[model samples]
Target: MAKLKSAVVFLIFLTSVLFQAQEREFWLIDTETQQKKIVKDSVSAVKFLDSLSKNHFIFTELKNVKKVGLRTEIYYDKGQNFNEAFVQLSDSLSSELKIEKQFYTKNLDSLKKEINKKYIDQGFAFSRIQSKYLGKQNGKQKVELTVVKDQKRLIDGFVIKGYEKVPSRFVKNIEKEFRGKKYDEKNLLAINRSLQNHTFVSLERPPQTLFTRDSTNIYLFLQKKKVNSFDGIVGFGNDKSEKFTFNGTLNLNFKNIFNGFESISLFWQRNPDRGQTFDLQTDIPYLFKSNVGVNMNLNIYRQDSTYANVKILPAVYYHLNNRQKIGLRGTFETSTVMDSLYIQGKDYSKKGIGIWYDYTEPTEIELFLYKTRIRAEADLLSTHYSKEEITAGQTRYFLLAERNFYLGGRHYLNIKGESALLNSENELSTNELLRFGGWNSMRGFNEESLFADFYYYGKAEYRYLVSNQAFFDTFLQYGELSSKALGLRPKLYSFGLGFNFFLPIGLMSFQISNGSEFGNEIRFSDTKIHWGILTRF
Candidate 1:
């Protein structure tokens, strides 16, 4: 009797366990679409169906989860509140809004957020989602969600703090453009970037929102900082031809003149190689209220004993977007080369239409530990020199890439490379050929000491930040200049240690390095000590 009883107990226990397992099966249904998804277990069914209420369109619902036999059936429907609210906002009215359905649960969540954002971006300031379970439907369970799109706000006016003398018309125009439109984050960011580019003001902080009874307003707070309107340098240097030299430059910049987005600049430089140079440039952005602008430059260059040139460039440039630009220029030149033993004096007039493209992206400036910046340009021109007896074309290409990474709190890695190709007709003159080997180029050689048709430069540095604005660095540079007719030696290499200071005025660096030309024997007598200031911001 005891053994029989024990066996009966074991059989009952097995049956109970199997029954509980069978109760876990379920089905997930989309009533409007008439589609069903089968779920194998109760735990998974509950989790998935519960997620649907929070994961569908802005106001979607998973209505029910009721067990019938071994299967749980889930019921889904649209929320009436959201459906009816949007109906008033649209031209067509329906009692129930057709839910924008989503397939994959993974993407359904993202789509729901995007839908809510559309209302928020359009000034529905109090829009939100609310979900709840509403018992059973047809022996299954029910859930409902309601979207509350509370109020629609319109832009009233703008308040700009700082710079009190700004014209009211200018403020009114800016406000008129956005007064009745939707307030969007992206548009605000674009405006900030544009203002920074033209006005030299940083708008990294977002505009503050102020609410009134009828609508909303935006307040832009401006912080004024040092503006780079004037820059000049004074220095002495030696080049390949001259053992000693005098150099100085003076620049004047007048920006946003008359509040019409205009820039005028005048530059004058005196140096031994070029004697005296003067340039005047003017830039007008958004010319005639369009996406294109005109730029004019006039340059007068004179070398007392050697040569002189007067060049004029007038270009119309189009901005494809923020990161890319293109321009077409008509150039005119008149020149005279002094008569020397190897060449006769000549006067020439060359005219050409040149096209150029520039691309720049500096996306990693704010990232931690690493950063990257890229710049590239290409220009082509074809001209006829009447006195030189050459009908020729010139092509110029330049590319630069820089990478910065922090190895630790202090150690940093910097790698930079630059390559240029200058091509012209075979009968090009002495002043037209390309040259390298300077503090800015090969680093340890005399200025303009290497002539080439093409050149490549690479630099690598390991640096330690001594302060917020200063760094100590060790660097190596390699260069290769190739020429066919000039027979100039090609390979140059250098290594050095330097300290760099990044001041508000510019970047200043000092370095001492030894350069070597590799040939039958390596000769390394060029010990160069270089220091300079550069302010191209």
Candidate 2:
């Protein structure tokens, strides 16, 4: 009897444990077709039904959920109301998400994604969306979406990772453009373009964004660039006697030496005819953290014992933005004949005021300098001839524009035009006329060889990029020159080919070109050849 009781007790305990360990099975039934499918658990049944709602069955409802023994039954009404679905926004998101308060959509899943994207782009990086079905209403399925916006991020400032010595003011200028704006991809890309091929600094990599509790900060990894440069060019050509002659040019530029984005430049050139030119300019972009800045220029030109001219220009400008500026400039000029016997030139003094504008848009590729650039100035002056003792009113206008167009891969079309006019009712003297022609202007002629009262030239260049640091180009130029004193009105054309490549020392350039008047035959003896190099540090 004792053995029987022990077996019976063991049997009872085993039965109870088996009953407790039984798994619950779920069955989903479609009310219309009466088709049933078995799922492992309640969660699986709900997920399968939700997917059907995303298809044409917009009004899908879990009408009955009943548990019996170890099995559960889920009855869903997959209503065929595929026409429209309505979205109801939560109180917190009503203003932001309610353009057409009740949107019509066939798929609830896509609508949820659309709403999520809207929040993400508006600085809600940590926002979450939860959708709940509220059954069918007015022949459409109604759903409520609640947004949990964890944080809204705005740009606070910038953090420099490398090249820490980069001027603080330069970074401030960049920050001022987008600070306090929403932290999004659009603003991030704008920052990248702003720093691309910058004069003083270049990006080591794309910028990064750091998120904090209070703000979003941009982290810049930069490498300081060698923008200060020394450029020299030497030219060889035949003089009137068919003898070889040499002319040279020197330019020295210092930038950001004081860490203020300021610059100083000195330029001197000697022409084959013994004419010489010198210029000095200084620019301070910002004054005591203000937008106003100053620029000063001094120039002296001597024309081979014929005449000499001196000019001084001082100006102040306001920063319109990072890439453009407008300013007012004052001019003082004096000219004298080198020899009293030189009757073609006269002694004169001029005082003038002018408005100037400058703009630059850097190219997307570092191989090129700029995508577009413009610099223009117009001045009105009162000129007094010391010998004649007569005062005349004069107007001077100058313009330079450059644009580069990309021609598919590794090719570019660069168009450049420059024009200058010195107008007066009185006869203009040789000492006061404009001089142009050189590697910087009309490439085929000697430096400062062409003298004119008014001139305009346009250049079209085709460039093939060999590498990041090398390119080959051929250019055609055509222009007109007018000079009343010389009694000349001539149409001229020039063509040139050049190649620039980078060496260990610097960038080296070489070109050979020739120019002639409309009726003159091109001659090899008239060709001008130039060799130049630019070293930046």
All candidates' lDDT scores? 0.62, 0.85
Q: What are the per-model C-alpha RMSD values against the true structure?
A: 13.3, 10.6
Q: What would you estimate as the lDDT of candidate 2?
A: 0.85
TM-scores of the candidates are: 0.60, 0.77
Clashing pairs in 2: none
lDDT per residue (tens digit) for residues 1-537 in model 1 = 234234433433443366774545567777787788786654555455455444433344545445566665667653432211111122221123444321112342354466577677877776785545455444333434456877787677788876534444445556756777666676566555444433434444667888877777887776543334565555445544746665556777876645545678898876535467789999875676565778999988766677777889898988665445688878787777764653633456666676766554432222112255565656675656666567777777777777787688878888888887878765455445455665556766555556677888898888888876777888899888876556664677878787877777776767776676666343343456666564544
Name the runs in model 2 displaced over 4 angstroms.
1-115, 129-147, 165-168
Model 2 Cα lDDT, one tens digit per residue, 1-537 = 234234433433443355557776767788889999997754565557667755666557656666567766667777776535788775557777656556667776777777787888898877788977888777677887788878888889999988888666577788889899888778889999988877778899999988878878999999877889999999999766777899999999999887778999999999988899999999998887777889999999987778889999999998887788899999999998879799989999999999999999988766567899999999999999998999999999999999999898899999999999999969999889999998988878889889999999999999999988899999999989999999999999999999999998888999989998999999999999999999998
Model 1 root-mean-square deviation: 13.3
